[model samples]
Target: MFNLFVDSLIILLVVVDPVAVAPLFAALTHGESAATKRRIAIRGTSIAAGILVVFALAGGTLLDALGIGMPAFQIAGGALLFLLAVDMVFARHSGLRSTTEREQREAETKKDISVFPLAIPLIAGPGALTSVLLMVGEQGDDPFVIGTVLAVILLVLLVTLVSLLASARIMAFMGETGANVVSRVLGVVLAALAVQFVLNGWQEGFMLIEENASQMLTV
Candidate 1:
């Protein structure tokens, strides 16, 4: 359980990449009043939290309804996460996880962006949503593990909110190079975790096939 909590926390934090998104947040909220910026940060984070929580709680059921098995979800989720990790390690913007240049330009022109780029794509993006589903599904209906994963999700969201609130200060302190260095380190860890997910999924899939074959032979 402790391991699950730690692993979930690490995966959530890395995928969320609060520090990397700080610059974007800062840019988006540039020249806004302190009160307005506060509203944006709070609103964005709250909406993002709601979205992630929904997916974490109901995502597995939704997938099951679609006849998607855990092994397949794990394999695909692992691959997607690995791609995002590669983007993080290279300090590049991945359309899978990050907003594109077009989005950024459009955001700059918008008066309100709490829900568009900030809450959806930037915070609760594909990688983050897929991660929550994978982690929750990996728990396999264990209440303790599920609770721990959910807690980690909330914790990461809290941290992300704080990072957004302190974007300017954090950017000033870490700078671009320092931020990239931290992201790369987390990216490496994420890549390893992604590979483990894929391996577990593959092994389980093969075992399932073998078991089916044996059952057929016995019958």
Candidate 2:
């Protein structure tokens, strides 16, 4: 349980990446007043938290409805996360974890960006959603494990909210280069985790195949 908590925390933290998002938040709310920035930060983080929680709770059901198995989802999720990790390592923006250039342009024109780029793509992006689903699915029907995962998710989101609220200060302190350096380090960690997820998926898949083969032989 302790290991699960730690692992989930690390994976979610890397995927959510509050530190990296701070700079982007700062940029997006550049000319906004303090009150407006505070409001945006709270609303954006709340929406993001809600989205992620819903995914964590219902993702496995959704996958089952699609007739998708855990091993396949795990492998695919890991691959997606690996791509996100590469983007993080290079400090580049991609649709997996960040807004596209066009999306940013659109965001600039919008007076309220809490829902568009901030909540949907920035805070609750593909990578983060995938990570949540993967973690929750891996826990199976263990209530304790699932609870731990949920707790970790909330904790990470809380950190993200605080980061967004303090975006200006964090940006001033870390700057782009400093933030990128932190991201690169975390990216390497995420890459290793992603590979482990893929390997675990392959192992589980092989075991399922072997079991099916044994059943067939018996029949």
Candidate 3:
């Protein structure tokens, strides 16, 4: 359980990628007052947390309603994350985890970006959303484990909020070169985790089929 919590924390951190996000946050909030930037950071992280919590709580139920299995979601989510990992390793922005070209252009023209690209796509993008749901579903119906998962979610979001709050200083200190180096390292980690997810999904899927077959034979 402790190991699970730690793994969950690491995976969430990699997917959230606060270091990668700082420069973008700094750029978007450029020219704003310190107070306003702080507000945006607060609101963006808050909204992102809310969105993730909803998905974590209801994602499995929603998938079941749609006749989707955990294995299928795991494979699809892992594939999407792997694509994001490639972009991260190369220091590129894939729309899977970041903004699209159109979103970026639109963001530039918006005054309040807290709820737009910042909260929706930047902070709580597909990578982050998929990660939370996967973690929650993997834990099944254990209340303690679910609570731990929620705690880790909050922990990651708190880190992200702090990163956003310190974006200016973080970007100035790290610069693009330094940031890319960190991103590439995390990218390798993310890629490995993504592959693990896919494999877990495959194994679980096979086991599920085997169990069904045995049950049918008994009946």
Estimate, for each residue in 173-216, the C-alpha lDDT of model 1 and write its tens digit.
Answer: 99999999999998999999999999989998999899999999
TM value for model 2: 0.97
Error of 3 at 144 (Å): 1.1
Off by over 4 Å in 2: none
Question: Which residue pairs collide, candidate 2?
Answer: none
- State the weakest 10-residue window (summed lDDT) of model 1: 137-146
lDDT per residue as tens, model 3, 28-85:
8789999999998999999999999888888888888999999999999899889989
Per-prediction TM-score to the true structure, in the order listed: 0.96, 0.97, 0.96
Tell me the whole-model lDDT of each prediction, alpha carbons only: 0.89, 0.90, 0.89
Model 3 weakest 10-residue run by lDDT: 136-145
Against the true structure, whose lDDT is highest? 2
Worst-scoring 10-residue span by lDDT in model 2: 137-146
Best by TM-score: 2
